[model samples]
Target chain A: MKIGIIGAGAVGSILARELNKLPENEFQLTVMARTARNGFTVLEDGIKIFHDIPVHDILSVKDTFDVLFIATKTPALLTLKETIKNMTHGNSEIIYALNGVGYDDMFVQGIPSVVYVSGQQHDEYIEHFVNQKIILPDQSFTYLDRLIQIIENDESIHFDLVKDKHFEQVRYEKLLINVGINSVTALSKNTAKIFEDDSMVRLTRTLLKESIDIVNKNSQTVYISPDFIDYAMEMYMSYPREMGTSMYYDVMANRTTEYQYIQGFVYNLKTDDHPPTPVLDTVVTLLSGYEKL
Target chain B: MKIGIIGAGAVGSILARELNKLPENEFQLTVMARTARNGFTVLEDGIKIFHDIPVHDILSVKDTFDVLFIATKTPALLTLKETIKNMTHGNSEIIYALNGVGYDDMFVQGIPSVVYVSGQQHDEYIEHFVNQKIILPDQSFTYLDRLIQIIENDESIHFDLVKDKHFEQVRYEKLLINVGINSVTALSKNTAKIFEDDSMVRLTRTLLKESIDIVNKNSQTVYISPDFIDYAMEMYMSYPREMGTSMYYDVMANRTTEYQYIQGFVYNLKTDDHPPTPVLDTVVTLLSGYEKL
Candidate 1:
């Protein structure tokens, strides 16, 4: 199978190395490169795996792949839209491992249907943060089944094909988690450990509830269930004591955040729904003030 | 002339020494102390002037002076209420060389009238950042006039009793300035220098405008004129580049702040006035989070 990944970030790097392990998958992996990295390497349990996968520039992208995955940050998705089209000529199954919701509607040009999954990006590779996977509607799970079979052929990486709503439910659920954890972490410049405090627990839950309400209003059916909230709370409790959300990383690194898309977007939507979201409003304003810093 | 100064902080200390220097007036000075201090010390131009003013506890405060000044922080004001009857015995005139507005409504229970001024608290002395002296509308300014005459008698301490509104205007003006400068400094954990950036400048101005609107609606008909805004911008610009506000000092020292009187009071008043103060609201909420830290 010919496969292409657009981004050379942690997620792209992880899949490049792990997916290459399948003997059934005769993969000619192509990586689109913007910056010239000396090499691509991923270390798992102290074992360093190197990918000699052909990394090419957009101008040099000439081959059409059977499957393509975009593993970059969400903001870069729109920017890389034109460049991504050059790498494929026909229909290809495109999997999206991104942080937030609503990526399928963004890329409108000639591209195959997309699948969304929750994944964590590290320096060298992406670590899957969740067990379940959700593939949205209008996309056949057969493509995912093929992708999963190729990966499950190897014992190293796990695979699953979850119901589409399961993914949508989890996406909104993760949005609530991100809204609370990401915002408080960024504004307070504290880690997730601080959220363990009773006061922060209350504040986080309030913000989570607000985001859940926002997600419900936006969705055709209210996908924010009690189980989703419970699952989110459990995920938070399972975090490493010092683990911080992506927004927290942004603050520590002094970079502009996805706040305009995440919290700010939700706040703007609040007026249309007339949902009382003071907690989200307050955090949006606070995080917005810190964006420039 | 005799002056009794309460709350021997920087403002009280400077006013005590400067007022005591009225030789032709032969001023008898007594400083009220919570715990007995070594007396008022003014360090000006490498010369340290110390006055052996009699210090008395609030319960035992008696033998009223010709003029009295209250220079305590707002948090300390409520405690002084309990001792007011003893503190204001006999024919004594009171002056409040404090930070905020509306002290007469607070301090006039035991004493019929008092004076007020607005300025910065220097270390163990008051530095007149802005050149103006305001006296409130009280019967005691006649006696206050004699004390002012003694202060003006000396060419060193330059001051004069301007109209009462001139004083009242600046008191709220200083409160607004504190509302702008102090709270941001404390919350961001940065010096006043941060306001020089365009984003910080814009945020600070938004906060100032919100606060000014709230103040005008709830308390007085105050306009934060363009000139006043420029004046505040200039003051922030002229701050010793690395200097943080006094509230920053409190936060760094891990002491409670006058936020209750500043932003806390403003938020509460906004509820009463039916005006929403989201900027101040967010600031207070985040500051509360910091306090929890």
Candidate 2:
């Protein structure tokens, strides 16, 4: 497989580096960065592995691959689409390893949306903070199995894909987790330790409950089951103890956050009950005010 | 009266500089900063005014004022209390120029609560983005009148007090505005220009409505008047085109935000409806996350 990862961010870098470790030499990887990096590199368990991969410009590159992974954030999806249209020729499958739903709404008309899971980026260093899971929607189980085989062949990267409605459930669950963790953590300027504070848990619960209601309203089928909280709690326990979300890092850098895409998007959705989103409102106001300054 | 400012941040620094203009024969201004800043200053309308203010260690300070202005944020209030208890004598009237309400409830015991109307603070260098209109509770009108005489004598600082129940109303009103603007701007990384955005207006309105509900639940007289949006719009127009709240600057500087005190406090309020506070939740989360990183 000739593979191209459209975003040279942490996830893209990790995938590129891991794919290079395939012993069968059945896969070739090309990565894309906003600017040219030295090459593809991944820091795993303190070992820094470098793959002398070609870093192509989204604008200047002209090539087609068997697979194209659109690893950029949703806000940058339009630009990614434009780049894909201008750069690639022939057929290529694009996988979106991003947070949030509505992947198809962002891409070219005919392209299939591949859901992805990988979390956080620190400079060129990609930390796979969560389980590496990628799912293609249209029952592409065979394709997923092959892809997993290629990836898991190397012990460094863990990945799997299950094309079922459960996948959507998991995405929404992840959204709930992001809602509970990302926005609260960003605003409080504290780590998971803030959750340990008993006073903060009620506020955290309110945020989580609002997300659950909003998700329930938007989705045709309810993704949140009776076990959703337990599911989330398990994931929370499994989370990298000291890791912060990408949203958290964005604020730390004083760069604009993905509020419009994350909480901001949820805020835009018109719902039945006026879900009290005071926390999100204040955060957006402060962040927007900061940007103005 | 020897006035002490515990945290020489935007409000503290500016208030210190403003109070310094008082007749040297009557008032001795001593500022308590986390670190020493020489000669407190506030620049407004390109006019630079310097005050020969003395900065002291929180614990090393020895003198008490007839009035002590505690302008540090609420989260830091406990720290200030520890220092103030050690440094000052009893009978020190403490003026807390904070954003949210309920200082009386949190007071260590017998400490007088003072609230004010100075709605905006630019930074350590700039002050008085808008006119100074300080508010005191209606019951404290006697103290207000005395402070007004001292402040207006300078012909520089404009001061006022909330008459009747309007004091509590205005405080809650101010909380609504803070709830709407501070964290949202910080999280979105947008400017006041965002308020001009329709999505922002809707999100802010929801927040104001929700906060009003929360406030009303606690206080019988407080309700969401038809004029709430109008009040905010007028305030926005009154704000300097380039001015942003102190929360904005704090996030920009990567310093911890006052989220816990402002949005988080309001969101945590007990209410019947459990109004959705998505905006507040998201912004607070994002800000908290930033601190973790």
Candidate 3:
């Protein structure tokens, strides 16, 4: 199998490393990044891990892949649309391991994956904090079965295939979790410990509730319950006290965040019938101010 | 008349200098500060202005004053209660030019002043941005009349003797303004320019409206209109782009903020009948987290 991954970000780098672990005889993996970087490095358990996977600039990649993973951030997807179209063949299976929802329509035969991982990139390597199982749609796609078999057999990473009918719920659940945890931590400049305070917990819960409302109202197949608020809070507390979100790192580093796809997506979904999401609205405004600054 | 001021903070230092401008023979002014520093300096319109007013450590000050002004922050009031008791004579008039409300009972015979001033302290000198007229009780109290006369005669400062019956409204209005502007600026780490964004303006207005609701519910005599939201937004916009509130400065300097007296005062006034103030609650919680950091 010939596999290609676009964008050598933290997500792409981690995925490339994990997939490269498969037997080289069966899989030939290459990363098509914006820059022609040599290789990618990731820090696992405070130890440095290096991968020498071949990386080529997207414009230089003339060959098509059997399976392609679009691991770029949501905001960068638009700029990569033409490149994505040029690199995919009729047999290619494009998997979107990106944040946000309702973007599946952008791809002709794209499969959205709910990525359950956290990593931060330094100058030389990415730092991996949490590595969990990714949830993908369970369908009759030939490449998906092969991809699942490859991932399921790997000892390092985990994968879950959910029914296609129930994939929206899983994706939105991940979105709400990101919306609640990332926004607060980014604004407060704290980590999971921020949720330990009762008031912080209440505010996070209120924001999650507002997001769940927007999701439920916008999607007919996905319905989020208020109880997910508690679940989200518990999940945040389960992370390390100093575990910072990608949004938090971006704000600290003075870089643009995926807020347009996360909070911005929810803010844009406002309708007449849905209740006013004052908390989400306020956070989105603050995040916007932060981005401008 | 012998006058003494407590707390040599930004507010205290400014009040001491303004009072020292009075006629030397008619009034004797001294500042009872936590430290026996030589003097205080303030920056006015980029010009370095120096004031050599007498400063004495509060514990060492033995003289009683005919008029006393408590210019300490709300948090420092508790630590100075005993010192305040010892420094006031039987005929002393205590004027609290402090922030927040319901603290008048802390002094047996106290007068509250709604101060409309903005200043930030550096290592050597404080920067005076705005020095507007202060609103004091319009009663016939002897020291108040003397204080007002001295202030009214001064060319640099201004004072307004408001009716004692309507003083709470003015005081609460100033408190609400501080609650809205200080908390948001502190949390966002931006200056008044943060309010320039429409979303920021909306969030600030929402928080202010919630504060006004709480104030109206707690006070039968004072009713804040929803239009005050627009008024407050305009006021914040009128400030210089880089103007940072005292709370913002405190947060930046990693010092404890007066949030307890500002946002905490409003949050504590919550009752079953009052509307939920989620924004204020969140800001307060974030401020609390900031304090811990």
Candidate topping lDDT: 3
Q: In candidate 1, how many Å is residue B239 off?
A: 15
Per-chain TM-score of candidate 3, chain B: 0.92
DockQ-based class of model 1: incorrect
Question: Per-residue CA lDDT of candidate 1, range A1-293, in tens?
Answer: 77777776656665555565556446566777676454576555455656676566645677876777776666777887776766654456666665655556654322222233334456665444433333334345434456666564657754333335355554555556777778777766666566466656666776777787776677774567655656666677777766667777666665667777677766666646475666676566546544433
TM-score: the better of candidates 1 and 2? 2
**Worst-scoring 10-residue span by lDDT in model 2 chain A:** A107-116
Report the C-alpha displacement of residue A27, candidate 3, in angstroms. Answer: 4.5
Give the candidates in order of TM-score, highest first: 3, 2, 1
DockQ for the candidates, in order: 0.12, 0.35, 0.41
Against the reference, the lDDT scores of all candidates come to 0.61, 0.61, 0.79
Candidate 3 lDDT, tens digit per residue, A1-293?
88898978788887787777778898888898888977878888879967788779888988777788888877788888888888788767888888877688777768788887688878888897776455777677767677777677777654343344577788888888889998888777677788778888888888888888888788777888888888888888998888888888876676778888889988888887777787888788777776665
Question: Where is model 1 chain B poorest over a 10-residue stretch in terms of lDDT?
Answer: B109-118
Q: Which stretches of candidate 1 lie over 4 Å from their true place?
A: A40-62, A109-138, A141-144, A158-165, A226-231, A268-273, A286-293, B1-282, B288-293
Which parts of model 2 are misplaced by more than 4 Å?
A22-28, A105-119, A137-224, A254-293, B1-7, B12-21, B25-32, B82-92, B105-124, B137-176, B186-190, B220-226, B237-242, B254-293
